[model samples]
Every structure is written in structure tokens, then in C-alpha cells.
Target: CWLQQALRATDNPVIDAAVRLGNVLGLPVLVYHGVREDYPYASDRLHHFILGASRDLAAGCRARGLACVQHVDRSGHRERGLVYRLGADAAALVLEDQPTFVARWQTERVAERIEIPVYAVNGACLVPPAVLGEGIGGRSGFLRRHEPGRAAWTVADDESTDIAPYDGTLPFVPDTLEGDLDALIAELDIDHSLPASAAFPAGRAAAETRLMRLIQDVLPGYATTRNDATRREGASGLSPYLHFGVLGPREVMRAVEKAAVGARHSIKFADELLGWREWFHYQARALAKPEQYDRVAGWARATLADHAGDPRSHLESLTAMLRGETRDESWNACQRQFLRFGWMHNNLRMYWGKRIIAMTPDPETAWATACYLNDRLSLDGRDPATYGNIAAMFGGSPGDTDRPVYGRLATRSDGSTRSRDGGAAWLAKAAS
Candidate 1:
């Protein structure tokens, strides 16, 4: 089993599927997870989180009577064609069915080159995107197909390995992650400037703690307080864990179902988690290149392109934006969250995304800038949901009047965050 993003041991369809197939064949499932220094934004933040998760993943696999191996691609530890080397001994390969970013591209290449039957399992979403079928036009349509199937997919069948763990490997020796992970990370050739997130610590323990917090603190009044950026506990703050697959939607929702919260709050949280999030996953699966600028709504693209040459006075440099030093205080507040914690409030992100158009040279630049900042600074960046949310901000209902840089596309304001009680004080402190 070749694991990329899905780091969890339990409730992981990829691993479970591998184990089932292995049991059927009377063969042991050898799980492999590698971290390279070359992926975009391979910083201290992303590396630390990934390595931490991977360490726990190995331990978890061991507890489940499965052997898991890892490789940290750094100087002196570089292993060429590791996956291919490992694939040479396998009866069949199992991989994650990721739609966006590096995981998608890498999985495709591997499946094409390898001769064995490569099974790509959907470990990311509660209901597999493939089950929803192709060409889902919008979220409402997606929910129609998705909602009915949720109850069936919510239950996890964690498969047990029938045979002993795989010990026959001809490839290079795997690095032991349990010993000095921090020292191992320090040797890697990645961005050292972007430090690890102290707020959202890595590992299964941290993820479980966040889930408990969601049930206990956040879910009670989630319906009413989710929109408010001022309250520290308003948001569930589970995006980082969800992104890395440390906690699957199935496990999270299972906890949600048992939580002692009001039905309304639980339902609202489910809508955001399953309804909105999985919808983006489904949407991205249909697109040729979901990350590109062309994937945005045609009308919004046409209108923005039409006003590309319009004069703009609010433009800021890339460095200013990267460092969260922009003139706009509210946008800076949102950016600082990404800078400091590698995460941001969903409510603040809507405003931060929309404001980038006026703050950049052009629409294309705006899109690129928004992507760059988010993808570089945030843990949940490079996800389908991230682009989907940004796309929503860029192309929404056409306003009654065309604007300066933004043509017919509706604009957003900081008033949502700024107008609340003590909201101004929050913004001032957040930006600082």
C-alpha cells in the first residue's frame, strides 16, 4: 500500500482495502509513505506536520499488526525510484485517489508506469467521488447524490491482516522515524523560514484532542457562532488534520453523531463538513486541471479579463502580501493567521480572497497571489476546498452594477468581521 496524504491507521479505506486484498491473496500488505524535499512549499511547517503524522502512522500500523515504512528524501538519504523499487515485489498496489495537487499527479504517473494492478481508493472523502459519478454541475446537485449515500459510507470496516507483515524488500533500507524526527527534518533541503505550527501540533493524539474540542466546545453553538471570527473557539479548527487525513470525515462524523449537542448545530456542522467540503472534492475530480486559473467560472474570467488593464491604486507587492504587511488591516489579519498558525478562519478567508483582486496587478495575478499565499503559508492549502472557496469568492452572483477592477463579479467587505462587537479590536490585534 502506497500512502501519500492519508496518514491515519484506522478508518483509512486505502489501508483497509489493501489489507483485504492482501488477505485474499494470503500476502502481507507493505505500507510505504515518503516525504520529498522538492514539493512546493516544503517548509518546516508542512514537513514537521507530515513527519509527525507519519511517525504516529508507523506506530499505529505496528499496533494493528501491519508493517509500515517511511523515507525522508534529504541529502545522503536520497533513494531513487523508491516507489517503483517497492512495486517490483508487490502483487498489487493500492494508492490514494486524490484529485488535486502532488498526490493526484504522482498517483497517475505511478499507475501508468507500473505493471501490477494499482487500486486507487478514495480515503479523502466520506463518500467516494467516483460513486457520485461525473459532471456534477453544482453543490446542490452534488448534495442530492451525496446526502442519500452518507449513512451507508459513514461506517468504517477496518480490515485486519491475515498474514504476517511484509519483510521481503529488495529496495533501499527505510529510515526509522521514531528516532529523532526533528533532527531528521533539520537535515532536509526545505524552507526553514516557515516554522512549524505550534497551535495545531501534529500526530493522532493532537488530532483526537481537536476532535474532542469540536464536540465539547465548538459544536454546542456551531450554527450561530461558526461565522464569527472574533471567538477563538468559534471554528472547529480541524482543517489541518482533515487535509492530511489524520482524521477522516467518517471518524469525525461518527463522533459528531454521538456528541451531546443540539440537532441543529450538528446538522449545520455536517453541512459544512460533508455538504460543502465533499462538493468541492467532487467538482475538482471532474475538471482537467482544478488548480489552474482557467477552471474558474467562464463569465467571471471573461469579466475579470475585460477589466484587466483598469487602473488600480490598492496594489501591494508580493513580499508585503507574503509577510502580511499589506495596507488592508483586515486582510492582514487573515493573512497573519496563515503566517503564524498555518490556518485561517473560514469567514476571514472569504474576505481575504475577494480583496486580493483589488490588491494585485490583475485578475490572473490576483488568482495566482491568492493561491501562492494560501498554498505556501496554510496547512490546508493545495486542497480542492481551498481553491473552491477562493473561486466562490472570485465568482459569485453578478452585482447590479459593474465595478472598477472587478467587473460584474460581486465584491466582499471586511464588515462581516469588522462590524461585530469588539471586532475592530480583534482585527487590530490579529494584524499586529
Candidate 2:
């Protein structure tokens, strides 16, 4: 259905309640307010799809068949009945359900506001499980099923899924939306406190270039050198592209598999990527206890709460870790990489996250800090996978179970030293 949030009127009291609920729920509602000011455009300067309509979209709908019946502003009342009189063959509205229960009410309100079909797009996962299977029960079960299909990621290159050849009618391309990138940035009023990461150029061409570089130059050495962090270029920097939908997961899988020379190490690296990235969605969707935002895992709340008041030690450790000043050389190297590159290898990510929980007074704060930095600085921000990965770290496993690392929070009672070698040395050099 035609999606215009601003054009739709609601009882002011109801609007206030809806906003309150959205806040309580932590859901970022996506309503098509008028066309985005200084909207992103195609390389040739044509706007194809609205920005933030979905992941990986790099254009605006102002030039499309869509009409802007309303502008999102401080005055939030408008009539939808008259807007519909403007007409379209069909309308598809998109929204999100996240963090809180208040989102459900907003969804209903929007649905009533616009009489057309509302397609609630689940914009998080790489491959939506609904498309793959009718809701695979939960996290563990979904992972079990998805694990085998790791090799099945393929591209729709052969016109099998191509929409280009279909209708003789050319797609609507909005040229008026070609925007000044600087103006858009200034208008958004993002936090200038944290400097922006490297200029990972935005465009289909740039995305392609990065992808090819990952497959050819970086991925081959991924298994061996990924944890070093000093050589930031060793790991595939494809996370941002993949997260943004600039590059599809299936396309990545296909490319890597084709290039793999039956090297077990390469295969191992691929499996880790799939498990950590693809299967993470499965875990998040499945794990009921962890999925609940307020629900902390078994013993996590009590253990972390007990020490929450004394955060000085943990804060010092975290500060050192973030600044690449950690005693451990490998962790330091990873910190340096994160400082310079705004990312670290998957192996290092687990280590860093676990260390944060171990060193932090409360596990929740640790998780929150990781999420904050990840979202703010990294190119791949605001992703469920990232959050889910952080969530997994809050609850320690075999790899990070050893403790008294931070009092009663230690999962492993019988602690034994398992030496971590490679990462520290590599990172030390990088930071130095």
C-alpha cells in the first residue's frame, strides 16, 4: 500500500501513547515521511528506491511512481482517505517489530491508516527463514538445519531471478534526488564526537571492487592471518557491504566456494563465516530466553549485578583494551586494528567480547558498550547478527570459561591456564 506516515492522522492521545510504546519497545519505526532530503542516487544520478526502505537500497522513491502526499514534520496530522484518492495500482508498507511490545500497536495503527496490503519486511537476516523454511523451531534447531546448507549460497546471475528482462516498461529513475553527500550528512546531525571510519566509498561499483578484493587477495590468507589484526587487510572487509545488502550473502558464498582450491583451511574459514554470520540469525530467532531484551540469561544478571557497584577495575581494563593498551599483545593488536580499521577479525571479536564481559563489573554494560561502539563506528552497524554475537559472549563457553577473572562471575571453577599466543604478539607489533 502507499506508505506515507505523515499524511495519516491519528488521535493526538493515541499518537502520544504510540510514541511512548515505541520508546518502551526500542523499535525504530520506519514510516515513509515525504521524500528524503538530499537522498542518495545511483552512480549515474538516478534515484530508484527510497533510502531506508530496506537494506542495501541506495536511492529514493521521489522519482518513482510513488507520490509524496505528506511531509514528516512537527505537525503530525493528515488524512489518508484523501491521499489514497491520489491513487496507485497497489501499495506496500514496511515496518519493524523490535525491542518492545509497543511496536505491535503502531503496526496496527499504520495498517488501519493505509487500507492497502502492508508487507512487514523482516529486514535483518541475510536469507529470511520464512523463505527458506516454515519457521524452523528455534536457535539450536535452526542452526542444525542451516549448517548443512552453507554451500548452497548461489547468485541469481543467469536471469533466473533477474527482474531486468521482464517488462518493456523502463523502471522509474529519480534524477532530482541526486544529493550533496556533505549536505545530507550535516542534515542528519550524526555524532561528530566519534570520527567517521575510513571512506569506504558507497556505490555498486565500489561494492564490486571490495568483493573481488576479498575473494582474491584477502580470503586465501584468512584462515592463517585473520587474528593478527596488525595486518588489517588480511581479513575480508566484506562485513559492511554484506550488512548493508550492497553485497548479498549468497553471492559471497558462491564466489568463495568457486575460488576455494579444496584447502581445508579455506573451507574452515568459510564455515566460521557462515556459522558466525548466517547461522547467527537462526540463533537470534530461535533462542527464546536470549531473544527477550529484558530477560538476562541464567546466573548472568545476579553474577554481574553483584559487582556492578565496583566498576573501576573493569573500567580500567576496558579503557586499556579499547585504547590498544592491554597487557596481552594479541588483544592489543586487535584493539589497534579496531582503532585504525573500525573492525577486527571474527576470532578477535569473540576474544574481545569475552574479555569485556570478564573485565566489566556488569555483563549488561559490557554488552551495551560493545554494541555502542559496533553501531557507532563500524560500517556494519545496527545489525541483529552483531548484537546476537555480543549476546553469545555475555554467556561464556569452553573458550572463555576460566575465571576468578572477575570474582563470582567466573563460569569455570577449576581454572587452568590455556595460553593464547598468536594474537597478542601480532597485535603488539601492530599497536607499537
Candidate 3:
């Protein structure tokens, strides 16, 4: 099994499917995860998180009796077409069914080249998009079809193989992640300017910590405080882990269901995780390029184009926006989170994204800038939610009134957060 995004060993459909296939074929599953320096937005932040997760994935695979191998593409260890070489040694390849970004691209390329039967398992979602069928309109229809299917997918698929782990890996030597990861990352040719996210530590242990915290602190007031942005406990801060497949939706929902919390709160959390997150995933799978500017709503794109050249004072440079040094205090407050932690509050992300339409020279540049900054700085960037949320910002239901720079798109403020008892102070502290 070639894993690009589905990093977890437990509760991973991709891994389970591979194991089941291995058992059926009487062949041991060889799990291969490789890191390339050339992938889009390869930075210290992504590499640190991925490598740490990879380390635990290996350990977890060992505990589950599966052979997991890894390779880091660096100056001293550059193996070209490693996936093809690995594929030649295997009977068939089972890999992640990611709908967007590098994972989707790689999977398509590898599937085209390999002669063996390639199975793409939807590990990123609780209910796979393929199961939902196609041409589902909007979130409500998605939920109507999606909610019924949730219970069936709730069970974890940790299939065990009777055969021993693959010991005969005849490819190149695999890199050991047990060594100093930071030092190893330094050796790679990725963005060093963007430092590792200190706020979100990588690995299964950190992910588990976040999950436990969600049960204890976050879930209790999640429904009320999730939009506040002032309270640290308002959000679970689990997106990085989720994006990297450090935590699957099934495992997360499993913990959430068992939590001794109110149904309303838990339901709200579930809606966000299962309903909205999966909807975006489904939407991305239907699109040729979900990250593109063209994905913005047709009316919203036209409205934005109408007002594309109308912006005056609010326009800011890419450097200023990138550094969170813009005149807009609320926008900067939202951006500083991305700058420092490589994550931002969901509520703030909406405002940050919308404000970019006015901040940039035109709608296209605004779209590109929003995606570039988010994908480059934030750990949760380049995700389905990232593009989906930004698209909503650019093209929300056409407002009754049109405005400067934004046109028919509705505007948002930090007031919801600021009006909170401690929100103003929180925003002040976050922005500084």
C-alpha cells in the first residue's frame, strides 16, 4: 500500500483494504510512504508534522503486524521513480483516495503507469464520495444522503493479516525517522523561512492529546464558543492532524460519540466534522481543480469582476498581507494566527478570506493570494475546507446590496468575536 495522506495505522480504510487484499492474496502488505522536496508548498512546517506522523505510523504498523517503509528525498538520498520500483515488487497497489492536491495528482499518475489493479480507498472521509454517487447539489442534499450512510461507516476497519510482515524489501534503503527529525528536515531543500508550527506538535501522541482535550475542555462549550475566536478552548485545533490523516474522521467521531457531553454540543461538532468537512471533500472529488479561482460561484465571480478595479485604500501588498501587517486590524488578528501557529480560527478564516478580495489588486489575484498564503503558511492549508471556505467568502449567496470591492458578496466583521466579554482583548493580543 502506497500512503500519501492517509498516515494513520489504526482506523484507516486504505490500510485495512490493503491488509484484506494482502490476506486474500496470501501476500504481506508493504506500506510505503515517501516524502519529496519538490511537492507544492514543501516547508519546514509540513515536513516536521509529516515526518513525525510517519515515525508513529511505522511504530503503529509494527504493533499491528504490517511492514511500513519510508524514504526521504534529499541530496544524499534521491531515489527517482521509487513508487514505480515499489509497484514492480508488489502484486497490486492500494493507496489513499485523496481528492485534491499532490496526493490526488500522484495517485492518478501512478494508477495510469502501473499495470496492476490499483484500488483507491477513501480514507480522508467518514463516508466516501464514491458511495454518495455523483451530482449531489449543495450541503442540504449532501447531508440528506450523507447522514443515513454515517452509521454504517462508524465501525473501525483494522483488519489483521495471518501472514507475517514483508521483510523482503528489495528496493532502496529506507530512512529511519527515529533519528533527529529537525536535523534531518534541515538537510532537505524546503522552505526554511516558514518555521515549524510550535503550537501544533506532530505524531500520534499529540493528536491523541488534542482528542482528549476536545472531550474534556472544548466539546462542552464548542457550539457556543466555536465562532468566538477569543477563547482558546472554542476550537479543537485538530485540523493539522486531520489534514495529514493523523486522525481520521471515524476515530474522531468515535471519541465524540462516547464523550459525556450534551447532544446539542456533540451534534454541532459532528455537523462541522462530518457534515461540512465531508461535503467539501465530496465537492472537491467532483471538481477537476477545487483550488482554482474558477470554482468560485458564477454570480460571485461576475460580481467580483464587476468591482475588481473599484478598490482604493484597502488594497495591500502581498508581503504585507503575507506578514499580517495590513491596516486591517481584524484581518491581521486572523492572519497572525496563521503566521505563528500555522493555523487560524475558522471564524477568522472567513473574514481573512473575504478581506483579501479588497486587499489585492483584482479578484484573480485575491483568489491566488488567499490560496497561496493559506497553502503556504497554514498547516491546514491546501485542504478541501480551505478552498470551500474561501469560495464561500468570494461568492456567498448574492447579498441584497452590493458594496465596494466585494460587490454582491456579503461582508463579515470581527465584531462577533470582539463583542464577546474578552474578545476585544483576545483580538488585540492575537494581532500584536
Candidate 4:
């Protein structure tokens, strides 16, 4: 969620320097990124399929009359300017996603360094975060007044969305992914120990298939069974789709509402999740220091200092938990599902996240590791909701401040009641 780490990790000083040059030229330079991880070598998943550059934004940019330049530099068809290269008109800067906190700062700094006006586009959401922010006023104020009014805000379709129709002349094309993706996966230099699950496919077709299936078959069960992790089709398997922006929330909500018009229960749950998304964003924005990871008001230095030495052991424990080898069968089963699929049910994710913080040394390490791994893997990584979930473990979450035993600094668990023997037997059968 934070981009500072990535900026430091970047090898491309040219991106910084060139953008600065563009700014000095009075051009509205749009910095485009496919993968959150910057530059040359990146996991294929990291690189997004571009429109003129990314799949959708190119058409959107051209429709808005922004000149689409494939500024790869060496291709010198025109007078290529530096990082500060600026456009004559307002440029529609299309980023792969919202810049991480570090990326956001660096982007602004680059804008300052280049002397251009940048409108940070909310490309991640079908409806941008800013639009959502506008709808929900300042964080604390919005939630206090509107938390109860969630039904109204979400029930209304985001009327402002406009994905410009694609024109053939656009400079970008969808990445023609070739060969075996599995073989490609092995080459990414990621941890090979974690196996990829076949349950979800890795492209647009896969995303649509899952969504279509859910609308037809699974949504009917959503009202009652969505929370039950054991029922594989219980909940809307739309998290990964929503996370990847493969299916827009408005589109999904509208489709579900249209199809399940008589089924108010499903409509209510879908609305609730969207509202939860708004709720999380409001909480994240409202925090006094949203960028400060792992440290809460009273629980910062002592908590970090207390758990510095044995991170390796903590890592091992977390890895074991991730692998579904822990003592809790219910948690282990959820872990197995996440291990096999890129997601877990929302109900299970809370249980899974709570357990991780409980076993790890400090809240920060636990939160960082969980978030990092999930972001790298889950289709929905790098989302506000995901960030908010990790945030919940620290002191208090969005809707409530009640410190749950899991994220709070404490050692408490009842072996028999929370035991997963029942779940373990089910998971073992499923794994086999």
C-alpha cells in the first residue's frame, strides 16, 4: 500500500529525471506504471496490460483528447524530453494503480521536480477513490454521520463512471501473454515453495468466467451461506475480480440487483460489502497518521522494541500458518483454501488475520508480512479494503475500537472451543 519502499527499490532514475524535464516544459506528463514494482525486471503479473499503454486508460485518455505518446525514448520519432517533459495540454496520467504512500510522495515530488500539474487518477477502482472520498466527507466526520446510512450511499449507482469506447488507433494493446504461464511463474524469482492454484485463471477471461458463474449460481446462496468457508460456492467469489478491477463494483451491484431483485438478502450483503469498502477507506483516511505502519498511538516503540530479536522464528511461524499447518483446524482449512485459491471468504480472512497477529511477535511485523504476501499473491492485493483489514489488527478498526484479543498484545486462546479438528478432517479430504 505504501510506495516509499518501491521508490527506494527502483533502478530507474530516468523515470524521476525525465518526468522532471517534462514538468519544466509545461507538459502534463502522465506517469504510467503496469506493475507496482518498478522498472525492467518484474513478475508478469506485476505488469498490467496497457490500453494505449494500459488496457483501458489509453482509450479514456484519447477520448479526453490527451495525446498518447509511447515515450520509450530511444524510438525518437519526436523531440523526446526528460522526466520533466510536459504536454501542451492537461495530460490524463494513467497509473496502474494508486501510487503507494512512498510512490505518492515521489510522484508529487517528481511533479514538483518537473513543474507540472498532476491529477492522480484513481485507476484502481471502477469508481475512483477520490470520488468515493468526495461522497464520504472527511473520514471521522463521514463515518460518524453516515455509517448508518450505508444502504443509501451504496445503493445508488456511481453515475459518473465513463469508460470511453476503444478506438483502433490507440498506441497500446493488451499484453499478448505467451507460452506456459506456469513456466513463466517459475522464472519470476518468487518463492517457489508456495504453489499456484488452478482454481482461478490469471487473465481477463478467467475473471469474467468466475463473475458470470457467481451471478448465475452462487449469489443465490450469498444471503445465508456466504460466511460458511466450507461451502465453496457460498459467497460471491468476486473479491479477486473486484480487487483486480476485472469487474467493477457498480457493474456487479447492478447485475446482482437486477438478477436478484426479488432476493433482497443477496442485495443487502452485496451492498454491505461495498459499504464496508467505503467504511474502510474512511477509517484509513481518518487515522491521524495513515502512513505510519505498525505503530498505533500508545503501542509503538515498546511493541516494536519488545519483538525485534526473533523475527526469523516469527517468520517461520507465519509461514507455517500460511501453509495451513497450525493447530487450529478451522484456520488451517482457511489457510489451505487461500493456499489453493488466491482468496478466502471474508469471514475466514478475519479469522486468518487475527490468528497471524496473535502468534507473531509484534503487530507491525505481523501486519507487514501478511500484507506483503497477500498483496503479492491475492488478485485483490494493494486495495484499500486489504489495507484496512491489516489496520484493524493494530488498536481498533474502522467501525469499532474494541480491541480483539487477536491483534491486541495478549496471549489468550481456549484450545478445545476454537479447535479445528473438525475442519482439519474436511481440509485433509479436500487436499487429497
Candidate 5:
């Protein structure tokens, strides 16, 4: 099994499918995961989290009686076409069906170039898109189909193999990630300044902690506190882990279902986590290139173009915006969360994304800047949810009011957060 993003060992559809295939074929399953420095937004922050998760993935695979190999692409450890080379030695190739960002691009390129008969598995969604079937045009139609299938997919698919782990590997040497991950990442040719998150640590243990926090702390008052943005316990910090595939939605949902929270809170959390997030995933799969600005609503694009030349003030440079030094204090708070912790509250993201329309020269620049800052800084960046939410911020439902810069595009504020108790102080401290 060649893993691109689905890094977990158990409760992983990608890994489980590979094991099932290996068992049926009467051959040991060999799992391979590699990191390239040239991947989009390669930095200390991304690399640290990835490598740490990868290390645990290897350990988890070993505990499951599977041999998992890894390679970290650096100055001394560069390997060209590793996936293709490994595919040559295997019976058949199995990979994660990533729908967005770099992994999707890489998976497509591999399927085109490799001579082997390859199979792709949906490792991200609770209900695999293929099983959701074809000819669904919109979200309502999707929900009509998707909601019925949720209960069936909630069960874990932990497939076991009688065959032993594959030991015979003829490809290049694998990197032993047993010690000094920070030192190893430091030597890579990636952006070293953006450090790993202190708030969200890497590995399966950290993922478990976040899951517990979701159930014990976040879920009980989720409906009431989800949009406050002032309390740390308001939102579950599981996006980073989910984005990296350290914690699969199945496992996360399972935890949520069993939590001792009110029905309202439970339903609200489920809507946000499973309902909305999976909807974005489904929407992304339908598009040719979900990351492109063209994927945003056509009406939003037209309105934004009509007001593209509106006079804007307090223009923040890309550097200023990136470093969280923007003139907008509320935006600074939002950006700082992404910078320091590789995350931003959903409430603040609306304000930050909408404000960027006036902060930049044009709507196109605003879209680019929002995506760039997000994909570069946030851990959950480049995801279906990220792009989907950003697009919503730009387009939304066409407003009756026509305004400067925004035109018919909906605008937002930090009132949900700033109007609350100690909220202004929270923003000031967050920006600082």
C-alpha cells in the first residue's frame, strides 16, 4: 500500500483495503510512505507534523503485523520516482484516493505513468464517494443520498491478514525515523522559519488526546460555545489530525456518538464534523480542480469583477498579512492562530476571509491571498473544507445589498466573538 495522506494504521480504509487485498492474493502487504521537499508549502510546520505522524504510522503498522517503509526527501536522501519504482516490485498498487491539493495531483500523475494496474480507495470520507453513486447534482440531492448511508459507514473496517508483513524490498533504502525528527527536518530544503505547532502535537497519541477533548470538553457545550471564539474549549482541535489522516472521521464520529453530551450538542457537533465537512469533500470530488479560483460561484465572480476597481484603504502587504502584522486587529488575531498554532477558529475565519476582499487590490488577489495564507500557514489548509469555506466567504448567497469592493458578495464581522465577555481582550492578546 502506498499512502499519500491517510497516515493512520487502523481504522484507515486505505490500509484496510490493502490488507484485504494482500490476504486474498496470499501475499504479505508492504506499505510505503514518502515525503518530498518539493510538495506545496513544504515547511518546518508541515514537515514536523507529517514526519512525526509517519513515525507513529510505522510503529502502528508494525503493531498490526505490517511492514511500513518511509523515505524523507532531502539533500542526501533524494530518490526519484520512488512510487513508480516500488510499484514495479509489487503484485499491484493500492493508494489513497485524495481529491484535493498536492496528494490528488501526485496520485493522478502516478496512475498515468505507472504500468501496474492501480486501485484507489477513499480514505478520507465516512461514506466513500463511489458508494454514494453517480448523478447527484447539488447538496440537497447529495444529502438525500448521503444522510441515509452514514449509519452503515460508522462501523470500523479493521481487516486482518493471515500473511506476514513483506520483508523483501528491492527499491532504495528507507529512512529510519526512530530518533531526532526535528534534527532530520532541520536539514531539509524546506522553509525552516514556520515552526511546528505547540498547540497540536503530532502522532497517534496527540490525536487520541484531541478526541478525548472533543468528547469530554468540547462536545458538552458545543452548540452554545461553538461560535464564541473566546474560549479555548469551544472548538475541537481535531482538524489538523483529521487533515493529515492521523484520525479518520469514522473513529472521530464513533467517539462523538458515545459522548455524554446533550442531544442538541451532539447533533450540532455532528453537523459540523460529519455533515458539513463530508459535504465539502463530496463537492470537491465533483469539481475538476477544486483549488482553482474558477471553482468559486460564477455569480460571486461576476459581482466581484464589477466592483474590482473599488478604492480600498489600509492595504496590507503579503508579508504583513503572512506575519500577522496586518492593520486589521481582528484579522491579525485570526492569522496569528494559523501562524502560531497552525489553526484558526471557524468563527474568526469568516471575518478574516471576508475582510481580505477590502484588504487586497482586487477580488482575485483576495482569493489568492486567502488560499495562500491558508495553504501555507494553517494545518487544515489545502483541504476540501478549507477551500469550500473560503469559497463560501467570497461568494455566499448573493446579498440584496450592493456594497463597495464586496459588491453582491456577503461581508462579515467579528461581532460573534468581539461582542462577548472578554472577547476584545482575547482578540488583542491573540493579535499580540
Candidate 6:
């Protein structure tokens, strides 16, 4: 079993499916996870989080009587064609059914080149995108199909492997991530500028802590406080963990269902977590290219094109935007969250994404800039939800009259974050 994003050992569809197949074939499962220095935005922050989760992954697999190996791509530890070499020994290969980013492209290439039968399992979502089928149009239509199926898919039956761990490996030696991972990551040839996030720690323990926080603190008042950017405990702050598969939706929802909270708050949390997030996953699965500029609505593109020449002011350089030094304090406050903690408030994301249109040279540049900043800085970048939310910001209901740079596409205000008590002070402090 090859895991790219689904890093957890328990309640993971990828690992569970692999174990089932292994049991059927009477062969032990050899789990492999590799980190390369060449993938886009390979920095200390991403590397540290991934390696921390992977270290725990190996330990977890061992506890379950399964073998898990890891390889970190660096100067001396370069192992070319590792996946191909490993596939040579296995009867079949099982990988995560990821739709976007490196995992999707890598798994597709491996399946084409490898001789053994390769199977992809949907591990990222609670209700698999495949189960929903295609051509579901909008979120309401998606919910009609999705909500009905949720009860059946919420439980995860972890498969047990009857066979012993795989001890026969002829490829290169694997890196041991058990101790002093920081020293090893520091020696690697990755971006040292972007440091590890203190807010969202790596490994299963940290993931569980967030889950506890979600049930105890965030869920009770989620309906009212989720939109407030001023409160530190407003949002669950679990997106990074969810994106990396440290905590699957099944496990999170299981906890949420059992938590002692009001129905209104729990239902609202479920809407954002499963309803909105999975809808984006389904939307991205249907698109030919989810990350492209052409994915925006046709009407939105036309209106923006008509008003492309109407821009006269408020253009910030890429460096200023990247460093969170932009003149717009509200946008800067949003960007700084990505810069400092590799995450952002859900409410502020809308304002930050929409404002990029006027802050850049053109509409295409605006889209590219928003994607680059989000994908590069935030831990949850290069995801279906990330692009889907950005696309919604770029293309929504047409306004009564066309505007300057935004045109028919509606414009968002900073009042969502700025109108609250001490909101102005928070923005000023966050921007600095």
C-alpha cells in the first residue's frame, strides 16, 4: 500500500482496503510513504508536518502487525524509481484516490507503468466521490444525494491482516524517522525560510487534541462563532490535519456525534465539515482540471473580461502580498495568517480571495496569485476545497450593475472581520 496524503493507520480506507486485498491473496502488506524535495512548496513547514505524521504512521502500522517504510528525498538519500522498484515485489499496489496535486499525477503514472494490478481507494472523503456518481450540478443537488448516504458511510470497519509483516525488501534502505527528526529535516535541501507551524502540530496525538478541542470548545458555539475571525477558538483549526489525512472525516464526525452539544451547533458544524467540504471534493472530481482558470463560471469570466480595462488604482506587488505587507490592512491580516501559521480563518478567506482581483494586474493574474499564495503558504493548499472556494469567490451571482475590476461578480467586504468588537485592533496587530 502506497500512501501519499492518507497518512493515518486506523480508520483509513486506503490501509483497510489494502489489508482486505492482502488477506484475500494471503500476502503481507508493505506500506510505503516517500517525501521528495522537488514537489512544489517543499518547505520545512510541510516537510516537518508530513514526516511527523509518517513517523507515527510507521509506529501505528507496526502496532497493527503491518510493516510501513518511509524514504526522505535529499542529496545523499536520493532513491530514483523507488515506487517502481517496490512494485516489482508486490502482487498488487493500492493507493489513495486523490483528485488533485502530486498524489493524483503520481498514482496515475505509477498505474500506467507498473505491471501489477493497481487499485485506488477513496480515503480523503467520508462519502466517496465515486459513490455520488457524476453530473450533480450544485451543492443543493449534491446534498440531496450526499446527506442520505452519510449514515451508511460514517462507520469505518478497520480490516485486520492475518499475515505477518513483510520483511523481504530488496530496494534501498529506508530512513528512520523515530528520533531527532528536526535535525534530519534541517539537513535536507528544502526551503528553510518557512518554519513549522506551532498552532497545528504534527502526528496523531496533535490531531486528537484538535478533535477534543472541536468537541469541547468549537462545537458548542460553532453556529454563531464560526464566522468571527477575532476569536482564536472560533474555528476548529483542523483543516491541515484533515487535508493531510491525519484525521479522516469518519473519525472526526464520530467524535462530533458523541459530543454533548446542541443540535443546532452540531448540525452547523456538520454542514461545513461534510456538506461544504465534500461538495467541493465532488465538484473537483467532475472537472477535467480543477486548478485551471477556465474552471470559473462562464458568465463571471465574460463580465471580468468586459471590465478588464477599468482598473485605475490599488495594485500591490507580488512580494508585498507574499510577505503580508500589502497596503490593505484586512487583506494583509488574512495573508499573515498563512505566512505565520500556514492557515487562515474560513471567513477571512472569502475577503482575501475576492480582494486579490483589484490587487493584481489582471483577472487571470488574480486567480493565479490567489492560488499561488494559498497553495504555497497554507498547509491545506492544492486541495479541492481550496480551489473550489477560490472559484466561488471569483464567480458568484452577478451584481445589479457592473463594477470597476470585479465587474458582475459580487465583491466582498472586510466588515465580516472588521465590524466585531476590537476587530480593528486585531487586524492592525495581525498585519504587523
- Candidate RMSDs in order: 0.9, 10.7, 0.9, 8.8, 1.0, 0.9
lDDT of 6 by residue, 1-432 (tens): 999999999999999999999999999999999999999999999999999999999999999999999999999889999999999888999999998899888988999999999999999999999998878988999999999999999876889977999998559999879889899999988899999999889999999999999999999999989999899779999999999999999999999999999999999989998999999999888887899999999999999888888854989999999998888999999999999999999899999999999998889999999999998889999999999999999997788987888888999999988888999999999999
TM-score of candidate 6 against the unseen true structure: 0.99
Error of 6 at 386 (Å): 0.8
Per-residue lDDT of model 5, residues 232-303, tens digit only = 888998999999999998998888888888999989987887778888898888888988889889999999
Query: What are the lDDT scores of the predictions, listed in order?
Result: 0.92, 0.46, 0.91, 0.47, 0.90, 0.92
Query: How high a TM-score does candidate 4 get?
Result: 0.63
**Which lDDT tens digits does candidate 2 get at residues 231-251?**
555567776655544555655
Per-model clash counts, in order, read: 0, 10, 0, 29, 0, 0
Question: In what order do the candidates fall by lDDT, top score first?
Answer: 6, 1, 3, 5, 4, 2
Q: Candidate 2 — which pairs collide?
A: 1-91, 1-92, 2-91, 25-100, 138-286, 139-286, 329-424, 330-423, 330-424, 333-427
What lDDT does candidate 5 reach at residue 263? Answer: 95
lDDT of 4 by residue, 162-269 (tens): 322223332333222233445534444434554544665544556568767777777776676665555666677766655544455555665666675347666555
TM-score of each: 0.99, 0.63, 0.99, 0.63, 0.98, 0.99
- Report the alpha-carbon TM-score of model 3 versus the true structure: 0.99
- The deviation in Å at residue 309 for candidate 5 is 1.1
Per-residue error at 306 for model 6, in Å? Answer: 1.0
How many Å off is the CA of 10 in candidate 4? 31
